[model samples]
Target: MTHAELVFVPILGRGHIVSMVEMAKLLVGRDPRLSVTVLIMKLPFDSDFDSYTSSLAASVDTARIRFVHLTCENTDAEISSASFLTNFIEGSKPHVKRAVAELVDSAGSTRRLAGFVLDAFCSTLIDLANEFGVPSYVFFTSSAAFLGLMLHLQSLQDEHHVNIAEFKDSAGELDFPSFTNLLPTKILPSIVLTKESVRSFLEHAKRMRETKGIIVNTFDELEPHAVRSLAGLGAPAVYPVGPILSLDGETKKKADGSCGGDDIMEWLEKQPPSSVVFLCFGSRGSFGEEQVKEMACALERSGHRFLWSLRQPPPQKGQIEVPHDYADPTEVLPEGFLHRTAGLGKVIGWAPQTAILAHPAIGGFVSHCGWNSTLESIWFGMPVATWPLYAEQQFNAFQLVVELGLATEIKMDYRRDFRMESGVMTADVIEGGIRKLMEEAGGERRKKVKEASEKSRKALMEGGSSYLSLGRLIEDILNNMPLT
Candidate 1:
């Protein structure tokens, strides 16, 4: 293979696309002959990914990566159901098919399509890869534990005739396979309980089994059991190449084309090491006014140095997504809250999460337990107080709190009743949760996470498990590549 090329197709979400691109950068950095081509999906409005991807690509002078946008006819309709997770990939199949055909047809005599790397959402395209006589791999931007649970859930639904929706009206312990945690009905992924999600997830589950191979953005040390189960699925291969994140303080740049957090960094430097608690939900997370007020009261009662990245509740009409810049906190939060906590706290529209989590002054994280945030906290050896909002976050939180024992739960049943998903958590609960996470005796969590962090770093170095596994995956794909 002279100039091996891989096609990466990522869905229309910030976390998903960013992880895929960063993985591309890593593959290019490690392999001299490899190159990656990313296919981006265009939306009705200017997307956050548009500026972020273009900016990041410009800084990398290696010429090893190229991005192409796949334009579709019904972008608005596609985005309308973006919460369905795989809807864009479903709606844009025609566009993706056309783009792949063009690329395959137009490549010169010397260049060859090495393989296809698809996001979990792009699983439906595996057949297209077969049509072109190339292998297709599904890249999961989540933890191995969650992946295992989803696979098990599919088996339960298919074989045992388990009705996942029954958990919605009733609450009890779940009989999940390969998952040691005693999962409550309240803590499943938001998708598992929704009627619409049933179809999307089932189709995705089936496609997952049909791929040539799979890769996960997690390490072996983090979830030995789950990763082991995934390998036992007997795929072409299951490669674990992660903590595959930028630990060097590279925040996902804002869509406006700026790093945008010098002031936050300067403030962090002023605080003592491990003194501040950083609170921020993931991109789509937002809270109702009641929850905001409760959080304000909790911060006051806890009397801890804090940095909160707050946003307004989701718009009444549409899906949950991050606003570029939200309005002032005084308007939405309780009166006098900002002023009372002025010297003791820092509140920003959007906190540079990757930078802040890597900071020395950050002792704890008050997170929505998004997998990216969860993995980042793990990489930096930070303890977490989990508050899951939506999607698969509840499941991630369960893993952190119960399975991994790396975090404390703020509210486990917050999303059990979807109608009360944004309901308030009392100031008492919030205060106690923060105190439990930040002021725990003996620092056992910090010690455990630090040890795990060390193991994760070593896994990416020479002769490490993750590094060796990735080498095997590359060799398998190259050896199996069809002759042009």
Candidate 2:
């Protein structure tokens, strides 16, 4: 059978790339006649992704899914600027248009061209898909709630021309449709606060709604209301094909950094079951040196066994894209801090997050509340103490703490640049939040998350909501093709 070929494009962000890659893997596995080509836009600062993709291809059936690369100028220095993100993605259009056109023109291409499945930020490619007479689908790397917020914000700006600035001081709640109750205007995305961000994000939202379908990275069981809101809004077709996650699968599991070889895992193995607290931010997650000191203080005072994968502070959004250099905890942490917490916890440079979350030794999570991490924690039935740093993480934190009631909050007010300012969470409050999730209300939170975990599992199982949605998507792609 000739495979139906779908091209997927992702913004250079790690989370966006990861989920899309997983989606590609799932598509090929579900239908042998479906093939995916992921076009990777390589930034100058990003390492040669060719070799990396080569390795990834070796791990999978390369005939089914292969990665293509397009080298684009890395606007590293500008990524921190509000307009830089807009500029970066928009800049990829010409190169992407050419690359995609070449793929469409290839005479020896064995697969039937189906359509495009692109990252939310890469909506610029939709025009190219249209020009090529191929269907265009969009994949949202975040939650359905975030999707609703995007639409609401765009309508608020474009349709109403209501000043987004007014929300800054308004004690009134955000009128975003996905939320069950009023959302404090203050906790709205930082992007909504500025004109450039508003214009760019609204543009992305508008383009997203124009796609043939919108694929969200959340299971129906996890975000029923938000998912319903997305579908009911009369936008492009909505498919909830996630918690696109795996429990025992190798595709989702990182190696033994969670097993006994690492000191952190060794310590975890020795600790009593469900006693150790796991703290990790996203791959780009970092805290200031001063904030790191405070975290040390909090961990020490919490008197909880712990595993911390600490990385250096990230550059500002518009600044250089220098990567994190993991330092010895003893060197970067407070003097004598490692010695003090020696027996009580373990601090490592990097962690295999999936492994740690799966370990029975883990009791609670202190996290930055990125959706991937949030989903992983929920998938494992572990409760969390949220500490949001940037992007829509505050909203994710809200979804966990307020909407789902499965997480406690350390501090939601900490903005993207809080490291330059100061620690919003004092050691006391940090310790308190950790304890509340691990001790005071740990049982209740665990039960809620476990139920969510089961539902999320079933949603992806055969004949379940997520599985059916994915099947429908594949069928739609296949049916849309011209009969050979």
lDDT tens digits by residue: candidate 1, 84-150: 3455566777777788788778777745788899988778888778888888889999888778777
Off by over 4 Å in 1: 72-87, 232-236, 248-259, 416-422
lDDT (tens digit, per residue) of candidate 2 on 53-91: 565556665577878777665665454567676677767
The alpha-carbon deviation from the true structure for residue 179 of candidate 1, after best TM-score superposition, in angstroms, is: 1.6
Score every model by TM-score. 0.93, 0.92
Alpha carbon lDDT of each predicted model: 0.78, 0.78
Model 1 scores a C-alpha lDDT of: 0.78
| Pairs of residues clashing in candidate 2 | 79-317, 80-317, 80-318, 81-318, 219-242, 219-243
Candidate 1, residue 361: Cα displacement in angstroms equals 1.0
- Which residue pairs in candidate 1 have backbone atoms (N, alpha carbon, C) closer than 3 angstroms, thus clashing? none
